[model samples]
Target chain A: MTREHLRILLPVLSLAVLLAAVFYLQPRAMSYFGLNLLFNLAIPVALATIAQMMIIMVNDIDLSIGTFVSFCACVTATLVQDAPLLGYAVLLAAVLVYAGIGAVIHLRGLPAIVVTLGTSFVWGGLAILVLPSPGGASPDWLQSLMKSKPPLVPMAIIAATLIGVLTHLLIKRSSIGVVLQGVGGNERALERAGWSIVRLKALAYGLAGLFGVLAGMALVGLTTSADANIALRYTLLSIAGVILGGGEFTGGRVSPIGAVLGALTLTLAASFLSFLRLSPDWQIGAQGAILILVLAIRLLVTRREAN
Target chain B: MSHITTTTPNRAAGLRDLVQKPWIWAYLAAAAAFGATMVISGGQGAGSLFYAALTFAAFSAIVGVGQMFVITLGPGNVDLSIPASMTLAATLALKFMDSNPSLILPGLMVAIGVGMGCGLFNFALILLLRIPPIIATLSSSFLFQSLAIWSNRGIRVKPPEPLAEFTTGGAVFLPNVALVAILIALAAWVVLERAIVGRWILSIGQNLRAAQLSGVPVNLVRFGVYVASAVLAGVTGFLLASFSGGANLNMGTEYMLMSIAVVVIGGSSIAGGNSNVPGIWGAALFMFLIVSMLNSYGLGAGVRLILTGLIIVTVVAFASKKGYAA
Candidate 1:
C-alpha cells in the first residue's frame, strides 16, 4: 500500500479490529460499557493527545500539559457549576499558564522539559490548593452535553472528530505552523533563514496551550467534576500517541489526523486491557511493549528507505 | 578578537582557557548557592550542616554522573531513564535479596545488569536505528518503568544485610550506602577521566564527526559510557533501597528529576565533552542538604516535589548555556 493508503487504512482497520475483538470476546462490555460513556471519557484524552503531538512536531515539549489540564478542570469544577461565569476565568487562566510556560522556556533558554515540569508542579499545587478532593458538580449545560445521546452518533465522537479535522486543516495552512515544522526539521538552519525561533516556538507552545484549554473544557463535561490528577497520565500518553502516529524528534512529518487515530488506538488498547481484567500493572508493561514495537517498526522502515 | 581556529591542540588550549575563565568561578558560585540553601535551611545546628551537605552531595553526585555521561556524548542529549533504571535496579535487588546477607552482591550485580541493559537498549536505538538520543532514552524509560513495577508488583521489600544501614541494625552511623556511593563515584571518575576508554568517550562527546574521522571507536565508547552510567544509577538504587528498607513502585521517580537537576546544577555541561566529577559531587551535596532541610521543616510530599521542580528550573536559569556546539 502507498503511505497515504496505509495511513488512512491503519486507523480504520484498528478501529475495526478493536470492534471485532470487543464484540467477539467482550460481549459483556458491549452491554455494560456504553459507547456513549467511552466517547465522553476518551474524547478529552484524545484531544489532549493531539495537543501533545502538536508541540512535539516542533521538536520542543510541553511537559506541563497534563497538569495544566487538571488545573483547568479544577477551575471548571470549582466554579463552572457554581458561579458559571467563573468558568471563563478558569479556562483563561489555564491557557495563560501554558502560554506562560512557553514564554519561560523562550526567555530562560531552560530546557522545556525542566521548565514545564516546574510549571506542572505549580499547576498541580494550585489545583490541590483549590479543590483538595474530587467532588464538584458540573453545570447542567455541561453535563447535559456530555450526557447527550445523538440520533446517529455520540456527540463526544463528533466533537473529537471535529477537533481532529480542524487541527488537520489549520496545521496544513498556517505560516506559523509551516515555520514550526521547518524549525523542528533543523533548528539552526531555520534560525539562519531569518525566522524568529523564539516566536516560532511560542506559537507552537501557544497552540499546545490552547489544546490544554480545549481538553479542560471538554473534561468539564466528561466527569461532571474535575479531580486534581485527571490530566497527569496524559503527559506520557500524549507523547506515546504522537510517536505512534509516526512523529519523530528530528521531525519532517507528523500526521495530525494519524495522531488522532493513534491516540484512539491507544485509548482503545487501554480499554481492551481493562476489559480483559488483567491486573493494571500489566498496562504499564503493555504500553512499554507496544511503544518498543512501534519504534522498532519505524526503525525497520527507515533502514529500508536508506537502502 | 581572536580568529577562529580548528586544531585539536588549539581546542585543548581553549579548554584550558575555559577552565581558568572567570565564568568558571561565577558558575561554581551560582552552583554553590543552589546547594547552600539546603545547608543553610538547617538552622545552624552543629551536625545538621554536615548531614545536610553529605546527603545533598550524594544525590547530586549520583544524578550528576548520569547526566555527565550524556553530556560527554555532546549533542543535545542526556538520560531521562535514570529514574527507571534506578527503580528497576533497586526493586530487583530488594525483592531478590530479601534481607539475605550473601545475596547482596548478587543482587547488586543483577541491578547493574538491568541498568546496563536499559543503556544498551538506548544505545542500540541511537546507533542502529539512529533515533535522536532524547527520544531513544525517553522510549526506553517506559520499558524500564514497566519492568520496575512488574518486577516486584509494587510490594515493599527489604534490602539484603550487606546493603542495609545502621538504622536497620546493619552498620554504624554512616550506613553502607554512603560508602557504596563514594566507591561508585570514585571508580567512575577513574574510568571516565584517566583511562584510555575515558579519552575515547570524551572524544565522541567533544566532536562526533571528528571523532569518527579519527577512528576513536565512537560507537563502542559512546555505548560504554551509557552502560556505565546505568550501572552507577543501579548502585545508587541499591543504596536507596537499603537506606529506606522498603521498595515501592514509585521509589525512584524523585530521582528521575533529581539526577538531571544534579547534573545541570553541578558543573557538568549536558553538551558532553569533559567529565565533571567534582561538580557532580558538589551537586549531590547541594541536593541532599536541600531535601533534608525541607524534611526538617515538615513540608508535605506535594510541597517537597514542587520545591525540587523549582530548584531544577532555577539551577538551569543560572547555569551556563554551553550545551551543544560549545
Candidate 2:
C-alpha cells in the first residue's frame, strides 16, 4: 500500500486486530447481546474523544473537558430533568465559557494546557456545588432515547457511525475544515491571508464544548444518573484516543472516524480484561501496556516510511 | 549627550524595576493572606495554624521545585508522572519499613531509587520514542498508579517510627520538614542560579536550536533535570507519608495540579526559560494559607477549588503579560 493508504488503514487495522483478539478470547463477545454490552459504554467515550479532537485540531488541549462534561451531566440530570429552560441556559453558558477560554488563550498568548487545567477545577467545583453528591436522575426523554434498539444492529453502533460520518465530513470534507487546519498548521500565514485566527480558534473550542455536553448527556442517559466526578477519567482517555487515532499535537491532522474507532477499541479492551476476571489494578496496568505497544508499532511504521 | 541621566530618576527607576519582579508578588500575596488569617482568627491559636500551614507548604514547595525544573526545559515539556511516582514511593516505603523503625533510611533510599527509575523511563520515552512529554509521563503515571495499587493491596500502612518522628518533631517556630524544604530550596537556588548547568538549561529553554549550535549538551542537561525532578518528588512523597503517618491510594492526586499551581503562581513561565525558587515557596505557602483560612471559615470544598482555579488563571495571565511588557 502507498503511504496515504497506510495512513488511512492504520487505525482501521488496529481496530480489526483488537476486535479479533477479543472475539477469539471470548467467542460470546461476538454475539449481538455481548456486542451491545461492550459498545454501550463506548458512545459517551467516543463523543468525549471527538470533543478533545476538536481542540487538538486547533493545536490546543483542554484538560477541563472531563470536568466540563461532568458539569454538563449534572445539569442534564438535575436541572434538565426539573427545569428544562434553566438547564439549557446553563449548558449554553458553559459552551460560551469554552469559547471565552479559547479567546483568552489566543488574545493573551496564553498556553491552552494551563488555562484548561485551571478551568478544570472551576468546572469540577461548579459540578460539585450543583449536585453535592451523585444522586440525580437523567431526563425521561434522554433515558428513552438511549434505550431505543433497532432490529439489526445496536443503537450505540448506529449512533457512533452517524457521529463519525458527520464529524468526518465537517472536518475533512468542508472548506471551513481547511481553514481550521490552516490555523493550526500556520497561524501567521493564515492571518496574512486575512482569516481571523482568534475567531477560528474560539469556534473550535465552542464545538469542543458542544460535543462535551453531548458526551455528558449521553453518559447520563446510559447510567440514568449523574455525579460530579463520574467522568473524571475521560480527560486522559480522550487524549489517548485522539493520539491513537493518528492525531498530532501541533498539527491539525486528525481523523474523526479513527478517533471513534479508537474509543471503541479502548472500551472493548477494558471490557475484555474484565471478562477475563483480571483485577482492576492489573487491568489498568495492562491497558497502559497495550497502548504503549500499539503506539510503538505505529512509530516504527512511520520511521520506516521516512527511511 | 543622550547617555546623560539624572541620579534621583535613575535610583527611582531602579527601585521600580526591583519591585516589578514577578516573583515578588507571591511574597506580597502570601504575607497579605497570612495577615488576613491572623486578623480573622482573633490571634487565638494562630501560632499553631501558622505552623501547620508551613509544614504542609513545605511538601508542596518541594514538589513545585521539581515541576519548575521540568517547565524550565522548554515549552511542551512536562512531567505528569510525579503524583503517581510519589504515591508509588509512599506505598513502597511503607511496605518496606513497616515493622522495623531502623529500616526508614533504607526505605527512603528505595523510594528515591524508584523515582530515578521513573525518570529514566520518561527520558527514554521522550528522547528515543519521540513521544510528547505530557503524554509519555501521563501514560507512565497510569502504569505507576497500577503498580501502587498492586503493591499496597488496598491496605494503608503506618509509616515507621523514625521516619514519622523526623517529620512530626520540631520547634514551634520551625518544623524539621520546613527546615528541610528551605534547605532544598536553597540548594536548588544555588544550582539553578549560580551553576553552569543551570545556564545551559536556561539557554536551551530560550532557544533549542541556538543552544544546540553553541555546543550545549542538550540531552544530558535535559536528562539531569528530569532525574532531579523525580528525585525531589520522591523525597516529598517520603516526607508526606511520614508526616501523615499513613498512605492511601488517592493521597497524591491533588499534588499534580497543586504542584503546577505553585510553579505558575510563583511567576515561573509555563512556556519555559524562567524560574523562581523563593517565589515557589512563597506561592506554596500562600496557597496553603488560603486553604486553611477557608477551612476555618467553614467554606465548602467547591468554593476552595473555584477560588484556587481563579487565582491560578489570573496570576498566570497577568504575570505573562508583564513578562512580555518588560
Off by over 4 Å in 2: A1-5, B1-14
Off by over 4 Å in 1: A1-23, A27-40, A79-87, A133-137, A186-195, A275-277, A305-307, B1-46, B56-60, B124-136, B166-175, B291-308, B322-326
lDDT of model 1 at residue A96? 65
TM-score of each: 0.84, 0.95
Poorest lDDT segment (10 consecutive residues) of candidate 1 chain A: A31-40
The lDDT values for all models are: 0.69, 0.85
Question: Compared with the true structure, what per-residue lDDT tens digits does model 2 show for residues B1-326?
Answer: 00112335658787576568678777677777777777778877878877887799999999999999899888888888889889988888888888478898899898899889888988888888788888788777878889999898978788877778889988868889999998999888888899999898888888999999999999999999888888888888888988897877888888888888888788888878887788898889888887777676777988877876787787778777876675
Tens digits of per-residue lDDT, candidate 2, A1-307, equal 3764666577788878888888888898887787788899999999999999999999888888889999999999999999999999999999888888998899999878888888998999899988998889989989988888788898888999998999989998899987888877899999999999999999999899999999999999999999999998899889988887778788788888888987887777776667677777766666566667667878899999889
lDDT of 1 by residue, B130-197 (tens): 76676577677777877776778657887765556442332333434445456667876787868887
Range of the 10 consecutive residues with the lowest summed lDDT in candidate 1 chain B: B1-10
Q: Indicate the residue-level lDDT of B10 in model 1.
A: 55
Instruction: Return the top candidate by lDDT.
Output: 2
TM-score of 1: 0.84
lDDT of 1 by residue, A22-55 (tens): 6677665564235655455667777888788777
